[model samples]
Target chain A: MKKSWSHESKEYKIYVVLCLILGLAIAAAGLYALQKLLVPKYMRGVVEGSMIAEYYESEVPHEVLFLGDCEVYENISTVALYRDYGISSYIRGSAQQLTWQSYYLLEDTLRYETPEVVVFNVLALKYGEPQSESYNRMTLDGMRWSRSKWDAINASMTEGEHMADYLFPLLRYHSRWDELRSTDFEYAFSRDRVTVNGYYMRCDISPEGEFPAPMPLADYTLPETSMDYLTRMVELCRENDIELILIKAPTLYPYWYEEWDAQVRAFAQEYNVPYINYINLRDNIGLDMSVDTYDAGLHLNLTGAEKFADYIGQYLVNHYELTDFRDVADVARAWEDDILFYDELRDAQNAELAEYGELRSWGANAIEN
Target chain B: MNKKILSVMMASVMALSIAACASEDEDTAPVVLSGGQTAESAEGSGAQEAGETAAASADAYVFTYNGIEIRMNAPANGIIEALGDGYTYFEAPSCAYEGMDKVYTYNSIVVRSYTMDGEDYIAAVELKDDTVATAEGIRIGSTEDEVRAAYGEDGQPGTAGIEYTLGDSFISFIFENGKVVAITYTAIVG
Candidate 1:
């Protein structure tokens, strides 16, 4: 009778252990599924928001890293760098990404692999403090969990954002359930690449138009906080033995003021960094504002981006001792797949333009009802 | 034995609670579209269908001089065609203004258009040279005193320009070299 009672107790203990493990497994899986569903799948529309996150999925190492807001991502063609110069690069960018955000992104990139040169667009330096929460989310939401990401969140959070909300995005995106579409479920596990090595392409051409004169600012000096980040970015690159290049993308408007340009030039000179204001070099680079720009003179379409990339690629080859991977069989084989993807995206965008008289499958309008 | 059953029941309840909250919160939150329309109301009346129909017939829509009769959100192409084909169309970058899409240039006159819910609307018209004048005879070269005499003494003066408010529209005259370099008429939309 005593032996039988002991056996029964042991059986009960084993049953409880099995049940606990099963419950915990189910809970963890459910949480992960919920998190995936709540996050924005940039596959369909507003794909610029997805550019930063897409960098992590790349298995190939980059020789160059371009970091900035829309100006860098929309204006540089990484594929062109690889195709024309055999220089692999990635642009870690998002919409209205601030200067501090760029610093943390560099820190994040160093963790994976250090690039020889880091090109930063200086336009974001105009903003000293955090901008809108939506823009912040577009830049930050795609980052994988790391101390760099945590610091980015802390530095970039606006008035109403909470760090806890970023840690568990379910709290911030709980309301997105009402806006869920079929794409949300389809891309819950994985997403189609939205950019070609961090280069967003637009094939359509819109001639540059008259822009409003920039309103006079009370203070023309660059914001101290933004300048501080610029300093930190320079320091971080120096520590990593990486060369940092400061550039102002030749975007015609949001008017890069002369005062602003002078400040950036002085900063670059002080840091002994290579600073190139593409706005001044547009004529030399052979960029035609009439055809090269997609939206008025604000951003370069694919043609202009390619031209800019070609010009910069030559500079990289001439100045830096980057390897020409064209002769290397393995590198060429890897790039072959990327080139195919780039051509496919270009053809798709052109087809969309022909069918709709405008691009409907890309940009912010790509999200379906 | 009871403890085991209780633990299983508690875990199940927690999971159910989270799922329930997701759906319930979604139901209570409002869905707003890009064009500032409620999703439910926009779908019911079909904003796109109505916009297409309106765009097709925008030739009949006209803004009388000194009046706000311009259709607030009709396609710019149809309206430009209605006015005349001599106008040059310039596609403005989407980032040019908060919501501007394109601009049509006619002689010295420029018309700025906005897009909402994939449909275009006339937002503002400006005269940058001596080729056009307002209904009140205020031309681009009109002086500040002349503007006040033509429109009214009830005007606001700022550092860069001066503005005179009409019913649902306002006229702004930009000052450069101490003279009016441009005059713009803008429609107010909610």
Candidate 2:
């Protein structure tokens, strides 16, 4: 007669418990693999998503922290800033980063290290609400776990986005199963850094073109929600003893209105903070839009970014008591390594430009789906 | 029984996963337009089908100028041709997305178009001056009371003036000191 397994037997209970534990471990491993394969590897084409996460890998403490959207990230060269004025700076900027996102990013940065100066670009203030799920992922996914990240995600979710999706990106991008490329698998475990201290490089230039006339709005007031967040940003800077400077990057399109400018000016006056509108200082900064901008007038190219860095670095040194890192040994050594990377990147881009006349590897054409 | 319970749990997980990632594509709320006519209300008011397509064709709001039918969410090539080639054109490339947003300016009107799937669709039409008027004869410099009289109370009120939606399009009028300063027809483009 075959013996039936007894439920009360010690061996049976132990075997069942072991099986349960093994099953859970296997399930967790499978989910992790799925997540690694599904999440976007922003290695090429639309590499803006990869910029935020790369901030953690920075070795040296930055005395200046730049916060905003593409304007700061694509328009300022940190390596150039170091080279010109011996200033250590990092831009915590992402694609279309909204106002609240900037505030939260500042909050997150304070957790790791506090910079003496925090320069914020004001273009993102026009957005009152979350803009896109993709943009939210770019700004939030790379942020390390903290209350700041949690609050940022909660504030930035659009109509259909769930906290679970942000928690397990596999939940949001599981539809990307069929769209997986070789980069997804290759970068599943590790990622290549795409920015030089938060500066996205574009070597090829598209000369400035005539922009559309600014359309009149029903109401010119910046969204109240955005303004509130801006107020919070100011208060946060005060608490951290960080000097905050507001800037309007010199992009011709996405037209900055005079009415909006007046409001920001008034706010700056009220707060006793300095506001610099680069549009007015374009000529002084020596930016010839014809050669300086890459993608028409939306952003500056490598040449333009370097000039901007030189100009801003001069301003920063003149105004603040900043440390000239070139005098410091360890910091200088680290910056030397960064300079090498920057030179190599510029050389590679220039080579591609010389070969194709247009960037087939970096700009709009290099976008991988 | 154990196998059955496990099957049920797996099915629930699959269902919950899909529910969590629900698609955000469809926008089916009824659009209310000027003169108190809605896509829903127009059905009872003897509106006829205007296009071959079934969705929103019958009730899509169109702005007419210089004997041309300018429509939101419709191809702008034919309308541009009808209005002639004397337009000041400007193009802005999308930041992270594909395609360019193109603007064409005529004498009294400005037409803006956006590209999707490699095709240009009319995104907005702005009446640049008092020379241009809506089909209901509302133009720049018209009083806010005139707008209330023509569009009735069904229009949505904003900080500037009232906005009326018809299908995938909306007409917004900007008023300052009880007079209309600007008028625009826009499409709710994805």
Chain B TM-score (each prediction, in order):
0.57, 0.70
Tens-digit lDDT track of model 2 for B22-106:
6422332111001111111212211122131223444566877776677788765556666688889887655554455779998
Per-residue accuracy of model 2 over A1-369 as CA lDDT, tens digit each: 966557778876776666655555665666778788878877767777788999999998899999999899999999999999999999999988999999999999998999999999999888888866667888899898899999999999988777877777766777676677788899999999899999998888888887778776666788899989989999999999999999999887788988788889999999989999999999988999999988888899999999999999999999999999999999999999999999999999899889878887775566554
In model 1, which runs have C-alpha deviations exceeding 4 angstroms?
Answer: A1-14, B2-9, B12-190
Off by over 4 Å in 2: A1-7, B1-61, B66-68, B71-88, B115-121, B141-145, B152-170, B174-181, B188-190
The TM-score of predicted model 1 comes to 0.72
TM-score of each: 0.72, 0.86
Best by DockQ: 2
